[model samples]
Target chain A: MTMTFDQPKTRTENQTRTGATVEFRGLQRSFGNVRALAGLNLTVGRGELVALLGPSGCGKTTALRVVAGFEQPDAGEVLVDGQDITRVPAHRRDAGMVFQSYSLFPHLSALDNVAFGLRMRGVGRAERRARAGELLDLVGLPDQADRYPHQLSGGQQQRIALARALALRPRVLLLDEPLSALDARVRLSLRDEIRRLQQELGITTLFVTHDQEEALSLADRVAVMNAGRLEQCAPPAQLYARPATAFVAEFVGVMSRIPARADGATVHVLGRTLPIDGDPAHGDVDVLLRPESIEVVAAADGSAQVLGAAFLGAITRLSVRSAAGTTVKVDVPSPAATTLPVGSHVELALPDRPVLVAPRKEQARA
Target chain B: MARLAMAVTALRGRIRWSRGVVLLIAGTYFLLPMVCSVVFSIDVPGQGVTFDAYTGILGADGFLDSLTLTLELAAATVVSVLLLLVPALITVRLTAPRLRWVIEVVCSLPLVVPAIALVAGIGTVLRWGPDHLADTPLYDTFIAIQDPDFPVVLVLAYTLMALPLAYRTLDGGLAAIDLKVLVEAARACGANWPRAVLQVVLPNLRGALLNTAFLTLALVLGEYTVAAILGYRPFAVWIVGIGGSQAEMSVAVSVIGLLVTWVLLLALATAGRPRSARTKTTAETS
Candidate 1:
């Protein structure tokens, strides 16, 4: 049997296919007293996959649903390929949506479920069946087409749901937490498979998720949202390195808040002066430093004492308490951290580059 | 190990005692009446037990006519109840969900209004309708509604009476499936409102439809109050009318009617098993 997981040419071929640009302009939606989407503006380029990442109740789902035509924004316009489609019904918008639940029609066989959209479009029986078969094969489930939904595993059912959504050849694909229900291992594999299929189709896609690793690993760009507003929208590396707000910095990865003295374009922390990115306030502020950025050295006269250490394959994370009674975590190579055990004294140093610093009042528990 | 097994056996005995007691009580409560009916139907005080009373009804006059009419009314009741409830339930659930309690109350109104009181109200309307509508075109409709071949009034009354049962069954089935999501999914696939309801929603509710239909069938088959009061000789009324003359045969007929109803209910319960489960069983057997 030939393996189909490694093919790469489909991404480019899909780029030339019918990938439409989707734009959300000044969208606002509210439910009772809670605002779901507050003047949201976002643009997804042709054939681009952008992940809308946020915690639950962050309105990331509401924004995605607005694009799918399942929800209407109270005061904004949604444009597909520069044409206003705010008033269009969901089915007529040419947007394929895969829900969080499997959402398969329990009455239909897997093949029939995949072919449902085509049937709705009035396609001929034989033609819809043939196309559905091809889609089943693409999702690596050709032999299970005759099985009912209950007979299939959860992963298999989701694959059929994906095929059903794609059977219509929609202009935009909307996936709302599609992998959140699966087991961890299945979630990883299926997410990669979905990403591969999406790239292959080259469809402009909006993927809503609460998983940071999933968003970082799968999307061409990630839009981090909070309280019905987009906090930062950038590529994964840029989002991680230079978050626009303190919320994004805390949400994206592990970072320790260290008290620091801030001046114009510079912050003093750990007895070292470091240039600060963006605007640096001239007062006491919180400096956010990644664990890897804090260099740890073993010394008898060290100011910090190692509290605990955890060996994580290639790297070891050390928790140390400094002389100022502030606890900070540091990461080093396993071989390097092996020498620094609990109760050992260590000194902490800072990186020379510019770091992200925010006003002290903005520092809240993530 | 012996002590552990003994403890498990004691627990099992306790569970079996509770289950067996409940089963025995239920069996006696329900079965004893049917057993008495069978014995009363077959036993002749002066003669040995025989099925002469059971066979006696085959040759009785008006037996076939009443049975045929009741079956037709049951069929009409099923069709009318489904047409009225399914569309209304779907529309209220998918669109104005705030009106759900109102719809539920309306569907169950027949249950609160006793059958005798409801029949009295309908009787007044039927009697006063022609006089009030005199000289108007609607006067003829009142006369036409009392057609003997197929009494529209009887069918109407039965439909209203069957509403609560049908509504509860359909609503339960709808609750089992995500109705809004299914409809939206279908609409997202290019189906219109009616097509989505017919194609996607209805197929998923096959079990509910069958249950409602059977419940209505059993109801209309045995209902005598409205039909007898309206001066229409439906099967139940005919059985009562014959009981005044031939008591044994009528009792036998009642036993037969009970058997037929039991068969229908058994079939309905079995048929309500999901198609996927049925296919799995078939495949295993094959």
Candidate 2:
């Protein structure tokens, strides 16, 4: 679905282009013996929003911090607008960052907090306040200008934080898990709001989040990291449909691993042979299948019995165990799920699309 | 039923009878001596209820000098200790957190050392400095710190004595707020380290700073052992010295000093409250 917002009118007229291209070249950071970023390289195009999606301790936040100039990379150079700022101090860098924690200055009123950067830049009081007021209105919190951060709700505080980050008109907006601290409903709404604002302002942004859904929904491209390395960087549809690595396939979405035997370019699973998606492997292998990709039908003499069913709004996920003791989860419409009760026999089938297969040992490691 | 009724009544005031009784006893214990002191200061033996003792405090010998010296020492101690501890604590918290325990131990070491021992050690150092460095340039430095007008030595001692209290207060404040996040946010907003600390960190720590200052001030004002043993006449020592000559006047001065300390505490508390809280308080009252 396409969502749109009016262009921000308060953006200064002189600032014709609001976004700047950011490049990370061989960025490496280490905390004692632990390597947070190892020779990482990625470039964000002007007006592009790239979400760094990874599990906890996967170095997504570390990468974001390195770009914000908070953490010094052991060996890399970060360039914004083609200018190297690796050695620049955090305050000197023009990267506006919104942290995961409640980062609004508790002592300042909302308006003053949003105007802080302009104040640091020596902007006149009247101008900064007017700009701050406009930004507050953009965030839909104009009436909350006089309130302190403690007086605002969590979602409101984050909205103010977003306004504060944008107040400086920074070249690149860095969000380090900004929505992770909020509740689920707020998270979804703020996720859309952030995407809308980013699009409206046309600011190049680096959003780091552990949630794949958030990444896929909001980012132009999602960079999946695993163990301090970029496993894959692609558009959400491509990343989901054609994951470059086993880690990416498993991490980006839920994948059911069914033991299969591979011969050359095809693998046999569930009494059917399928073409291998990526690398051709022989011998014992595990084929990964998305829950929705498997077609499930109730049959009186089916080989599998339904173990459990979990209702998830429109779709219900059913856990089924084959006669061979292999358990696979399948997603079917809630109406069809009602017909397949627990202990009922079912049949599963895969489509003609190539299936991702990983060696049993490699799948275990991933 | 009677006990239950009394307990419920006490609970409505947010103080149980047991707590109320304990507070009443403690108040009496602390206030009885001050009441007697006031009575003694006002009631002359043969003359009825004279105000001469209270009024004569300003005219008393060495009163103004001692008071001035005490205030200076208190101010200097507050500044020096905050200067020494604030940045150190913040740096340790932000950069080298593992070393926080070492600083805590060092700051708290003064508490274990007795005042007499500390003064004796200072006296030994003072006597040793002149004897060993008589011909050296350092001899003059030793004499300057011991100057009676504003003894830098006493200020140093009081700063050491105030370290534990100041560290705990500042540490508690730092703990309550996410110091790293706040500083990073300020830095992202284009504030340099000094500006971030001065404008963001210090304002947030206003309560802790005021509390540390008050504790140091009270400590400096009431300290007699170190100053007296070191042969300095700060207010506390002056009060003791006057007690030998005029008992009623000395008691009156002590009462007034206590009252002044309470007033200063109240002022600091009101000043340290967050602006929003203060505004709300004013609004509520209105």
Candidate 3:
């Protein structure tokens, strides 16, 4: 960890992919007796944006703070490039951070706020201002350099915060729920803006957020954490499509548990035993099916009664009750989305995608 | 019926008018004595109303010295309070919670122990002995009874009364701010705590601190108990002494104290507060 922290390398766009990298090694931190991070481990590759997706109190922000050196880890180390910064003081660590509040200096103009870090590092006023102006322009706030924080809207302040973080060219940027306070419209707009900036700079970034759409859309890989543990760390599609555990499957998106009797390779659900993905024994297990996978049809052939339906633009979502009284949702195109009314029979089909399964109530992690 | 309604309306209007008159009369009654002091300050010593009272005040033997002494005392009090109060208030803000309460109680203890009692209880105040302040001791402070620089003693008495109020006002101002904005903003910029406090947090507290300073100065200007009891030659005491022979000059001194206090308090009241202290929570999720 120490070795990596000392020599964080960012290639000057010589290649398309190389820039800052962060590696967390058995990082552990605690607040008094409450363990915020219990042996947490994750890595954000150079130029890669990784979102630490988790529920509240799941230590996702704690992990980010530890990496940023705001909160010291009781055990293990945080390595940027190859140097360990577990014991590094927050200031000397020189990591860029964008906070949930956008934390823009209230008294400073947008330009000066962006230039503040450079000035702190002993950069001259003229050069720092020029650089700050450039960064603000990069963030699409060129003419707003003179605006005080209150004069700008919420989105602009966040953009300024990003520019300020990038001012000193830190190897890794930590965003602690940086967009958690904006309206939905602004959030969507700024999320794309942040993604674009990250790609352009090729700077390693660890974004912490509880929003699954944000994590899925912005990150190259999503590290889903729950209860002080990393449940799954993989590309967003893989996290949603092939969740490693029941916790990850539920956390990433909506899922349901079903009674399944598993025999070595195949699991039987509702009298249909096909190929199962998990390695549980011939007993009851919970299965997770994505809404997109299953389709409802006429009840004569595996049909079930429609319990309810939700109309999402471009698609319609239906929850159908099977013959065995199990309800499952299926999302179909808007044109064919009309499902059987409540109490009307409908058919449910189990597609060939590998379904995630977990042991019953008393079972351990899958 | 119409004629009776008109009479009732007239009665109500008359009652309202009389109430307003009563209030105006009472307000004037309360202000009359203070206004009379200002009016008397201009009354002539011999025959007519003139600036003689003002002139005679400066011409008096002890009055001039004490006037100089009073100005010096006010200055010293302002300086001392700034030196002691500002740092103490700041320390209270940054210290750990456990120790913060202890320090607060200590600063407030001076107020709890009445200034007169504080002066009386201390062996150093009542009886002068060897190895005292400058080998001289008189009551609360040596200067109050013997040093002739009455302003110094008066100012010391002012600190005893004003320190707690200053702390409270500043603390209230500090409480009104969102401290997290400063902390997180500084941390995000790689600023250590000290730099953040100096450049960010303290600047935000300008209104509060300045208000405290002006208030302390005003309190120092009006204080008389510690000076009078300790044999200090403060302006208020001198004004009291001269009221028998030269009432006009004494009134002039009273008017000066009132004017000085009013100005200081007005400055405090008009100080500008931080306009941008709210936390800017940008986006909830993105």
Best by DockQ: 2
For B78-161, candidate 3 gives per-residue lDDT tens digits of 678767866665656654545766756866887788877765654354355434546444334543435564435445667767
Model 3 TM-score on a 0 to 1 scale: 0.83
lDDT of 2 by residue, A103-204 (tens): 998888889999999999888898899888888888888788888888789999999999999888888999999998999999999899898888887899
User: Rank by lDDT, descending?
Assistant: 2, 1, 3
Worst 10 residues of 2 chain A by lDDT: A1-10
Q: Report the lDDT tens digits of candidate 1 across residue range A124-204.
A: 898888878878988889888878888999999889888888877788988989999999999998998888888877889
DockQ of 1: 0.58
TM-score of each: 0.90, 0.94, 0.83
iRMSD, per candidate, in listed order:
1.6, 1.5, 4.1
DockQ of each: 0.58, 0.71, 0.36
If ranked by TM-score, best first, what sequence of candidates would result? 2, 1, 3
Q: What is the DockQ of the complex in model 2?
A: 0.71
> RMSD to native for every prediction?
3.8, 3.1, 7.1
Best by lDDT: 2
For residue B212, give model 3's deviation from the true position in Å.
Answer: 1.1
Candidates in order have lDDT scores of 0.87, 0.90, 0.74
Candidate 3 stretches with Cα past 4 Å from truth are A1-19, A278-280, A298-305, A321-327, A362-366, B1-33, B44-46, B59-111, B122-160, B266-286
Worst 10 residues of 3 chain A by lDDT: A1-10
- The residue pairs found clashing in candidate 2 are none
In model 2 chain B, which range of ten residues has the least summed lDDT?
B277-286
TM-score of chain B of each: 0.93, 0.92, 0.71
